[model samples]
Target chain A: MQRATLNRMTPYAFMAPAAIVMVIALLYPLLYMVWGSFRDWNPAQTIGETEFVGFKNYITLFYDPAFRESLSVTLRFAVIVVSVEMVIGVGLALLLDRNIRGMSVLRTLFILPMMIAPVVVGLMWRYMYHPTVGTFNRWLKSIGLEGVDWLGQNALMSVIIADIWQWTPFIFILALAALQSLPRSALEAARIDGATPWQQIWHIKIPLMMPVLIVTCLLRLIDAFKVLEVILVMTEGGPGLSTEILALRISRTATEFRELGVAAAMSNYLLILLLILTAAMFAYTKIQEAREARIRAAAEEDM
Target chain B: MPTIRLDNLVKRYGAVEVLHGIDLSMEENEFTVLVGPSGCGKSTTLRMIAGLETVSDGEIYINDKPVSHLEPKERDLAMVFQDYALYPHMNVAKNMSFALRLERRPKAEIDQKVREVAEVLGLTPYLHRKPGELSGGQRQRVAMGRALTRDSATFLFDEPLSNLDAKLRGQMRAELALMRQRVHKNMIYVTHDQIEAMTLADRIVVMHGGYIQQQGTPEELFKRPVNKFVAGFLGTPPMNFLDADIVERDGTVWVTGKGFELALDGEHADAVRAHRAKQITVGIRPSDLSFDPDAANENSFELRVIVSEYIGAQSVLMCDCGGQQVVVELKSETPIPLGETLRFSVNPAGVHLFDKESENAI
Candidate 1:
């Protein structure tokens, strides 16, 4: 009996180190943030010295017009960026899915933007979006068109465009992988079934790729909400908070505004939103797996 | 129905030519089976006809009109792939109606056509189920149903029944034959299984190494193959080949080898006399060799039975004739002593002869 008990304990003992590291690295900081969200604290003082405030920071954020605007901006940015990127990425994948010489090189070049650090991407785009001597304005001038103010009046659109450029390749590579992995014979059959090229893509390829595209959309949405570095560097939430996203607002509230408690509460809200999205993704996958399992079981029963 | 013709069809993948100048023509409302081993260009030829693979050289003519430049949709053909290739996202009804829907046919017409096809293929009950939720046989039926709903001039099948289990394959093969009778448009089916070719084809075109070896009625091809490859490739317990020499002795042509001698008469003798080479390959089907102890040496083989596979009514006996391996299909009731020489008489009419160097029928 003792030996059996020892054998049972062996697995848990082996798992102990990982569990302990997870607590230190992930759980501890998460609990600290949650604890800090309920306190009236500032960066200047220790958490122990701060007075406990019971959801005051949350209530303030809920009613703050600036916070509401920032939330709407984040949502708009995520929605626009994700939808536009999906269309362009999937379209590019469909166009480039065929055989051509130097295709591998072309694919590698296409995904190059995604490999750059986010900070570098931000700085590069900031330079390109410059009004007087930027790449876009200079090109416009050379083309005999008047240069427009990119960062002044159209700061949100400019930031959204930059984000799309940096992240479109992520969806492009994944969509291409999914497209290539589809059954080749099915496409061939569709071709022989009197489907035009457009019909094949619309009816067969898009529908078949829906599952992968949905998961990819959800992941990009989540990442888009948490985006801060690129927008921060490009616009700095500048020209009266026109491009201030939730992540940017959170950082500013903690540092510039000197309200650590409000920032923590804002972070908690963002975390909850993300958790819901993640749960939806997981639930979608679980439903898919269960359906497939049921299908297999039903098929086996028939046999 | 339009008669489809391939005039010297060629397919090249960059530097390598996989199919070399295939010339074939199918009559309207005829079933043609392109049967061969894997990588034998049978499926490639079928795909070329279906317009799935681009024609590298030569031209395809549908009713004497050049169609090589036409797209698959414009070619008006429907194909059933080896994997069934059913749309996993669509139900059986939707899959069947996809072609009609693309044509923008009236909804009532589409529904009627889909219902008729589903009923015919016994897929009506599963019409609302996605392909992922169906059994292999049901998926195969859906594929057939999809092709049937197209109402195209030509139908192409690329080893459609190959993915099914053995028993299911046989059942589907019979169903395909039944469907072939009901839908008599031009059908070009590809498979490596000779039994499928023999059972379903009005004309069987045997391909090998990217070249068509023979194309004829199944009976004609079976009784009179043009080459050694066709003789061996088209039968169950495939034809046994033995090295032999043709010799004319006393005006009687004799095929003499290590273990047995076969006397040739009529056309075989005339062909052997006109041929230049004495060395030849002797072909005999397993079904043509029967056990008879009293048979003469000229028409019988003394084989030592090595292994007997009992398969219900018929048993296949693996035997050794001299040093070469031989297989014999015989009734299971015939008690054959193992490891001992037994006289198995050859039917004179079933003898086949081929030139040693060219491997062509003599």
Candidate 2:
């Protein structure tokens, strides 16, 4: 009886460290934020001294044009970035998925943007988009075109371009890995079946790659909704609220506006949205696994 | 149907060559099978003919037009791979009609063709299922069905039956033979099994070490093998060789070798007289030797029966002959004692003689 009890406790014992760390690092802050979202708290006041308010912060932010604009900007940014990245990344993968000289070096170069720290990426793009002296304006002026404002009138577009430049490598490496693992003989049979190169891509390559591409797109979408550092550095939600994405807005609400309740509520909304996305990805994979299991079961039953 | 020809075809990988200039002419509607051990360049030659491999040298002709430079699609050929290579995401009907759909054929016509071929292959019930949901045999049949639906002028099969179990392989082999009779297109098959070559081929091309050793009808190759390797390779319980010398024994040609002497038949005697080499190797199939204790001396061998292997009605008796091994096939009812010397006579017409050094039949 004692040994059986010990066996029952062993799994929990093994998981205890991770559980404790999650509580301290994740759950504690999350629970604290939920509690703080009900109280009109200030950074200067202790948590116990704050006067409790009921849903006023969330109700107020719902009608605020600035917050609504921030939400729309984030939605637009996430959709555009992920959609463009998927096409370009999968296109590059299909083009480079064959034997060529120095292909390894080229593939390595393609993924260099992904390995840099986010802060470093932000700083690098900030310098490259500097108004009077930047890569784009320099090249533009050199080509007999006048220098145009990069971070002033076109701040959202500039930040979006930077995010795409940095994050595209992430999707490229994943898509390339997916393309390489596909069965080769099937593709050859396609060639012999009178499938032109375009037809093979449309019918064979894309269908086989759909699963990985869907997951990759969701991962990028989730990351896009939370992006802050590059925009924070380059535009600072600036040029009259044209580039204030959700994460940047949430940070400014707590630190600059001293509205911890509204910030916590905003963070919760983002969390809920992300939870829905993650659940979707998980359910998709589960359905696929269940289908494959059914197929194998049917085959085994036939035998 | 178009006739296929490989004229001095070759394949090379960088500085190393795999196929040494293979030349073969496969007549229209003929089932030509290339049989060899692995790394013998048979599959390479077939792949080149299908335009999957770039021809390193010489020309491939289809109905007398050069096709070496053409693409696989342009050549109007279909291939069945060893792995079946069915599309995992597509249903059976979709896979069979993929070529027709790619060609933009009318939808009703495509459906009709797919249904007809699927019915022929007995895959009608699984038309809606993907390849991943099917068994290995079913996947192979789908691969076959896909090729059959195309009705291309030429069909290339690269070791298609090798992945199947023995029972299924035999069944599929018969189905393939029936399919061959129905389809009059030129079919080129590659396999390592000589039995498959002998059974299915209208013309068998035997390859070894990247070279074509011989090409002929199965009966012609079996009855008159040109060399030692061909003789030893084709038969089961392969031919046994014994060192011997040709001698003029009282005006009749006799071969004395390894604890026995045998007089040549009149037809072989004329060839033996024309040969300059005195030394020769005599080969005999195990089936050619019959247990006959009362036979005359010139046509029989004295052997020490060592062990008997009983396999149903016929038993194979491993025997000893003057320090070398010899095998004899006999009825299980033959009362042969172990460790005792006995006489097993060989059919005079079954005897084969080869030059000692060259290993070539004389």
Q: lDDT per prediction?
A: 0.91, 0.90
Q: For every candidate structure, what is the RMSD over all alpha carbons to the true structure, in angstroms?
A: 3.1, 3.3
DockQ for all candidate structures vs. native: 0.53, 0.49
Per-residue lDDT tens digits for candidate 1, residues B1-362, read 68988899999998999999999998989999999999999988888887878999999999998998988888888889989988888878899998889889999999999989888888877776789878999999999889999998888899999999999999999998888888879999999999999999999999999999999999999999999999999999999999999888888889999888888867889888888569999999999999999999878889999999999999999999879998999999999888888999999889999999999999
Interface RMSD of each: 4.8, 4.5
Error of 1 at B17 (Å): 1.4
**TM per model?**
0.94, 0.92
Q: Give the number of the best model, judged by TM-score.
A: 1
* 10 residues in a row with least lDDT, candidate 1 chain B: B121-130
**In model 1, how large is the Cα lDDT of residue A80?**
98
DockQ (model 1, Cα):
0.53
Which sections of candidate 1 miss by over 4 Å?
A1-15, A279-303
- How far off is residue A267 in model 2, in Å? 1.8
Put down candidate 1 lDDT per residue, A5-55, tens digits, no spaces: 999999999999999999999999999999999999989999999999999
